[model samples]
Target: MKNARYLPLLLCLCWGGQAFADTPLDLSHPAAPTVHVEINNVKGKVTIIAWDRNEVHVGGLLGDGAAPLSIEGSENNLSIKVQAQGHNGWFNWSGDKAMSDTELNINVPRAASLKVNVVSAPLSVDGIDGGDIAVNSVSGRVRIDARTPMLEAVTVSGNVAFSGHAKQAKLQTVSGDILAPSLGQNADLQTVSGHIQASGGPWAQLNLSTVSGDVQLTGELAPSGTMSIDSMSGDVQLQFPASLSSSVHASTFSGDLRSDFGTPKQPEHGPGSTLDTVAGNGNGKISVETFSGDLRIRKQD
Candidate 1:
């Protein structure tokens, strides 16, 4: 009787092992030069590559038990999403009984605008050079190498790394670090307890903020550019070329301040310090404030 009862268990184990079927994916559709594309996946890696062709091609494996990809719209705008079987809405599951991991490798026109959302799937995007690119995730690391017009990427507890050019970019995280090797004309980066590191040239506007994390910036400011930085208890470091022309004003409540431009002033009977100096002709503006974190300003060789 015990052996008979164990047969059911053995069958279940066999079924579980073969439950996830790797369904092949091959779909193509005509696309406009600047078509808007959106893709959503809950728990699998998504890779988007830019192609010279004027059509969007999707080829990958769809996990069994998952619904067919919901592809909608026309050549100008399109939406692609993966959902669970018999489920009509999106669900972010992260435990036993979660959906099988589906992989999506999509190729779109180089100039198509793109957007992707996922719960815990890492996203990689490359070569997009038109419109805007936006990505959102719950806990998935995002990396982009695109020369788009605008970029907006946000995640919760996932790191973000960008290495490309954009007219305007906004990157944020709630406990994840941000690395931008080449910032755009205007960039805004924020995090909570996550470090921020960026480098670029002649930024017209730059905004950085963090709580309990460090901020490191090495770039150039435009002649009329403006920068604002705020932190509760994080260190801030700014590195600029020797030929920088900016008016800097930085203050801290109970932290040390060091600068290569000018000396920091301390009140006679206060627990705060300030740095009010001008670099070169002071054509730009910079403002920094912190609660209890150190500040360092240096010249970049």
Candidate 2:
């Protein structure tokens, strides 16, 4: 009878051992509606969602040998970092083969300001409203679905996709495509060897710069909006509504230029062409400059 009683204890110990192998995390902190949250991670997926509650919740699975998620700072300003265990310094796991990766799922207030930094890990943010958001990544795709006043995203060799509205946005990438279907008032997009495809807004000001990458923009312009595209050896295409009023000035050096509003004029002595004309009432301004790239300006049906 004594041996039978010990059997239950042995089973309990075995079950506890198995549970200890996988590290689970569930943490929360009280936060204000406009709280500032910063998350720094390396080499793992991070997903953030905005909720109506005024608190920050972080829950995820840590890989084997990974350190627990660290949350610090006050309620107004908080920072979350994931460090690899058995590392030489805090949050530094360079040259450590036994380091573990982390997959984080976080929830913050809907109006909180967020800044996320990652290296080679995909980052996703959704359902944010009325706060500044910035995401910086290297070689990891970034997807955002938010409506904020200001938004900025930068990536190196990773695609960026946004489906929302913002008052002002700045996006930069290298060798990765940028796709934004719904952008807002003012946008500045820059890329090197990466294509930019965007459609949105009656923008007040839009600036696009690229080197050896195509740029395609289709949207409405504010009454006095200004849109400019500068490219080097990449195609540029802009499509506007048929009733749009814009002044266009396009020039190309050794490139083909096609416009629906005006006729192209080539210099008689130089190997270049320029088009300077006004469409509709010419209330807006559109300028495109390219070198050895095809430029097309179309009127939307």
Candidate 3:
């Protein structure tokens, strides 16, 4: 029994180390804030939590119903090799069976910068602390929770959700919704088929354009810069704090325009379909245009 137990333990250790022995990656980039990670998951959620270090931490879950894999990293950097035994391309190009052979789990520093590239999988990042982040996917939802913002999120077929505060922000999505909060001076939002919702701080200059969805702005839009909103079939909602003011140039082609903050007065040049109202003095420019929906402006308490 002693010999049997010894033989089994040695065999297991040898087999584990030899299973995928041909992998080629250094998997280490010591003490770097520029943390890089690549995940190859056929299916399964990839979750990352940030730490306070200046290094990158990585972990992943791969294959469908595959054996659990433990991913280990010190400061920053992680790699997961695809199991070659799951490939049967000559017979089937199916991931269904290949999905059950690999798995991973890891923890990373929150303030470290990240570059994540993935294929056909949803990537979720929560409690990630710092640095600018870029996430690209074939088709997946990118969820980010950061304390401060320098995040640039792009996706082809998945929605993006960013939660935190930012100084300068830019977001592009092909067909996904964007929810971001507390942006700083300037922001550029562009999308094809999804809705955009943004709010908070130092609203210096805002430019939003969409082809098939609506645009909604809430909270305090700084009274200093230019703001523009354009959409095709959806309406526009602008909610402003009491102190915010702008040079209003708002109109609708086939839809009614209504304002609760009152309107700016226009100098009479032979009145036709023109209207104006004023408070004391206007601050900046606010332009709203829509094809078929009403423009509603409200004042927040």
Candidate 4:
């Protein structure tokens, strides 16, 4: 059995003439404090960290059969692109099959702006205090831990986890779960066929929507804040403190509606139910709607 495992390695070595090679990368460029950095990767992993220095440092490895990484633009604005040679068409490009992975570890100024784009490559960003940050990925897990002014992340078919403080945040995913345990002020979350779990926000405005995915929110609402959640065939649950002051309005068709604030009024002849009531002083506004899914509002323990 040990020889059987070596046989595959021997065949791989014979077929490719050698093992996969790694090309080291160590590059640095002088950059301004408010520089804008853009990265585009097609395969492998990308890790970005914020540093106090006013320069950009990139160190990583490029695997065999992968093209050389390219860095372009100037100090004020920089762009990095990882391209694979001779792979163009969509049907011909099997992600990381013919091309080797490209792993990058980059450090930039804390005050700089960042924009990243990836396809089938996991991305991670951490410890950044900066301007607008945006990441768009296709089928790659994205994890962001930053304190920025504005943040937007979107992915398809990969999970997203965010833990940071932002003035404004917008997160969206398709067929992938989202977990935001510590989100910031204004948040807008949306998903399709994926669940959402979030907490720890005194948001001024919060909106969550899903299609065929469950939604769970537990946090404190700001005074006079507005929260709205809509779902289609998915359950919704909201947990707030006992001292919450909010006007809750919930409606559902062919689904159960239960709340700890007040009793709901169900039509005696129809297939719909609604709850319109006020809790405490009614300083905040909460609205929830669902179709064929249960809605539960509970007080936090």
* Alpha-carbon local distance difference test for all models: 0.89, 0.88, 0.62, 0.87
Local accuracy of candidate 3 as per-residue lDDT tens digits, 1-301: 6688699889988997676343322232344554554444544456667665654434433444243333344445554334324553212235444554333343555565556654455777766555666677657787777754566778777888877766677778878888877666778888888888888665788888887767788865565677888777677788886676666666666555677767623335531112244323576667777666667887876
Task: Show the colliding residue pairs in model 4.
Answer: none
Model 3 RMSD vs true structure: 8.1
How does model 4 score by TM-score? 0.88
| TM per prediction | 0.92, 0.89, 0.71, 0.88
Pitting candidate 1 against candidate 4, the one with the higher TM-score is 1
> Residue-wise lDDT of candidate 4 within 1-301, one digit each (tens)?
6688799878988877655676788888898998999988777899999999988988998767666665678999998777665654322365447777789899999888899998888999988886679999999899989888898999999899988777788989999899988877799999999999998778889999999999999998899999999999989999999998999999999889998889888998988789999988999999999999899999998
Model 4 per-residue lDDT at 225: 91
What TM-score does prediction 2 earn? 0.89
Candidate RMSDs in Å, in order, are: 2.5, 4.9, 8.1, 4.5
Ranking by TM-score: 1, 2, 4, 3
Q: Judging by TM-score against the true structure, name the best candidate.
A: 1
Over 153-215, each residue of candidate 2 has an lDDT whose tens digit, in order, gives 999999999987988999999998999988899999999999999988799999999999998
Residue 179 Cα positional deviation in candidate 3, in Å, after optimal superposition: 1.6
lDDT of 1 by residue, 15-111 (tens): 9777766688998889998999999888878999999988988888887767877467999999888888877676735321357888999999999
